[model samples]
Target: MRLLEAFRGTAIQLPNRIAMAPMTRGRADDTTGVPHPMTAEYYAQRASAGLIVSEGVWIDQAGKSGPGIPGLVTAQHAEAWRQVTEAVHEKGGRIFAQLWHAGRVAHPGVTGRTPVAPSAVRQAGRIFSAEGWTDTVEPRALGEEEVGEVVRDFAGAARRAVEAGFDGVELHGANGYLIQQFLAGNTNRREDRYGGSVAARLAFPLEVVAAVVEQVGAAKVALRISPGNPENDIVEDDGKEVYSRLLAELRRYELAYLHVIDTPDTEALSYLRPLWPGTLVANLRSEEPTSREEGELLIGSGLADVVAFGRLFIANPDLPTRFALDAPLARADHDVYYGARLDGYTDFPAFDPDPAKFACSARS
Candidate 1:
């Protein structure tokens, strides 16, 4: 299938076109912000993927959203991630650390500080914390000086991710996170240079991306964006202009890839795909997980250079192998999707075909 073919068009060469989309699994130490030992084994199990974008790793303590979310802030956190990188490298797999920051979605109950955003816009949303789910409070509007600090935090985290032995780092500029908070018109209402017009609203995310690219080379940088996604109560009324200008500015840098998260409500994928100059990674959103045929058509049609699978990679660690062998896939348990245990994390075994049973059935 076209999806299983080797990819060489980008700065990063891949063994296949199948990518493991990043998914947040709350399995890290809540206090230390270090990834658990199982985290290493979990990623290594899926080493057959062409590339693995790790679950969101917060850049700073205050950037963390809730318990068990991993961070790359301190030396200890970097060392813990070293094991994960080494394990994947041992199996000849490439992985990228996704840097994340939750702006207004961060609850003081979790980080013990008021959340910060480009403006004081409060979304009617819920945020998880040590005290459990609580109403998201109106965040403190970041001062112009404070904005530079957040940009530096992203740069520092990118440096640490490279030191931790990640193949590269991808800025989590999607799904209504901190960067998206700046991009969305409703979330960003500041009159400063960081927010106002489409150009001003594009300033913060572009600054973060540039800082990360300078910290590491452009060859080691990638970005993810979700346009028209209402996640975390985000509203992008001027999404077309913002995204169009964002992509135009991004083309100035020769980055690794641009990951686009698709929503059924928008034709952003087809609209933006042709605009990107470098390698493009598409996570085509649907009610069900992306199937092999759908992935095949996506790659075959030239809409995306690589196709990323989220839940499919959760259950099928050897997903590419299953696609090649035409074997049955196992279903993942939704209850354990976010937890500290190995029940639904690493316990799901790879596809194992029983030749003996097939032989008996053929004889019968």
Candidate 2:
């Protein structure tokens, strides 16, 4: 196909089309959500991807992550992120901070404050805190004025991302976070302008996108949306109306890409792709181990411009190399996925055979 031909040729050059999906490595310092030196090296090691979407980074303190999840809110966070982005850039990599706000998913114990959402809905799950796992508390419903403040927070974060040297920013409008919670009918039962009809329900998210686009440029902003896979209590009955209209509006902004998680029926991608004007990234696990042929086929057939590989990128530092050579993939360790230490985070070995390389790679 011309896609493969374009990618393989020198004249039709773009870097590698495979992208590293943002995976939260809870290795940031607990008191402050600043990334460490090791974090820079970790991302720099995997600079081969055409793009790297850094893990879900909190836009404001209210949506701050529990324990070790890094944030991009403060000057300190921006400085630390500068180091990370500079390191990746030195390695000839492109990166975008994935702006996140984990509304109902956040706990007061972690934020040291009240959780806010579209409504005072309690997520039916436990969130990992510094003390330990705790049941999610009911979030306070945001007032109208306060909702506008949150949108400003998103714009502020996007500006911070640019200052921190990111090539772009991806709004984490997926995975049942603040925006998704509001978008889904089951979670958001408000009678205000932010809820009710599907169009009204999507107001906040759409506004945030428009704000960020104004702060950054249209080509520098991307949106990630999961239409139907209810991961963190996001339920949408009229998924077609909500997502189809959402995509239609998104086309107006001329976004860099739309990253959509694959659903069981593949309804989201199937319905939205024909209408989307920008690049589309389809994220899903169609098989146990993703083959180069599979990724090639997707891009080759015009299904996606890029395929985001999650766990496989975690275990294999040289994922692009492995894909190019069609090597056996490594399995990621689920045990140490989160924490302040680098044990399972930055310790994953690279393709280098040198003992010192392995030694330097390992962390306690």
Candidate 3:
């Protein structure tokens, strides 16, 4: 069968091709990782997407981002996530918990301790903390034993996600997090076995994948990666060869899908697609949205099986309906993209928010 056909047959079923990107809204209850009542209502509102990838959720204490960001290690976290998954599922939507470890991106004020990473180099950026946004400190480098502990943390988190009733788990390997920290050369200046060459650098992520797949079946596991993304100071020197080998390694597991974010041209996608050997979800930068006309072009031409939208999904809860009917889309408020609250998060009006506004396409 074709790649798109295979995606439709396996894993989560999508009512349409549109899938919501894993977006962070920071609405969890304090320290418990419980979704706020508003947060539950927010996701329930956006149930129109074929699949919803929940925000990046920390797997350990030291991996947390701020006061409201959730973690998946404890029973409290599981119970909280259960509410979220059940709410989305009730609305006929499938969800995946994006497993995350912030690594050096975390601040001591947030974790009440220094963050852990492959090396001691502090990320050259500020991180959100309870007090406020603060510069990241030099994180303590993980000893060889600590690496194994981190791996176990991820596996345990995967088990907790299953307990929480999520359809699957997507490893947070993108956006300069712990996994990306190891993948980058500048942040990882260690002489350890997990550092130095691209193959060695990928060891930590590969091990985490293996551990998670052992806990959850390979068909229920997906990984997200961003090549040449410097948003968080993630430099990818010779990223092509590095990602080529990484994709080859992923082929062994038969992952449910491989999601790549914001890569413009097809050069990297073309190079890595054959190596992946599974469903490909490409999230391109779309400013002027049109059924993801450009995105559909890529899909029809066979560059990707699905297209994930970030801001578009944020603004338009009923995006698939809007696309099919060519309805007007609500513009997203960038101010509320991060931090807490439901002003711009859940209160965004959809086509049928009120009975008067429900314009059936057949009405025309």
Give the whole-model CA lDDT for all candidates, comma-separated.
0.90, 0.81, 0.79
| Distance from true location, Cα of 255 in model 1, Å | 0.6
Q: Write the per-residue lDDT of candidate 2 for residues 1-364, one digit (tens) a residue.
A: 2222323321112376777888888888777888876999989988887789999899887897578888888999999999999999999988989999998889888989889999998888788877898888889999999999999999999999999999889999888898888888988989989998888998999999999999988888988988886888777788878989998888787777888877555457677778785678778644465556667777776767777877888888788876664455667767766677677766777676456754564431
Candidate 1: residue 47 lDDT (0-100): 95
- In terms of lDDT, which candidate is strongest? 1
lDDT of 1 by residue, 20-70 (tens): 999999999988889998999999999999999999999987788888899
For candidate 3, write residues 15-79 as lDDT tens digits: 66667888888877756777777766777778877677889898888888677887887787788
Relative to the true structure, candidate 2 reaches a TM of 0.91
Deviating ranges (above 4 Å) for candidate 2 = 1-14, 285-291, 352-364
Better of 1 and 2 by lDDT: 1
RMSD after CA superposition, every candidate = 2.0, 4.4, 3.3
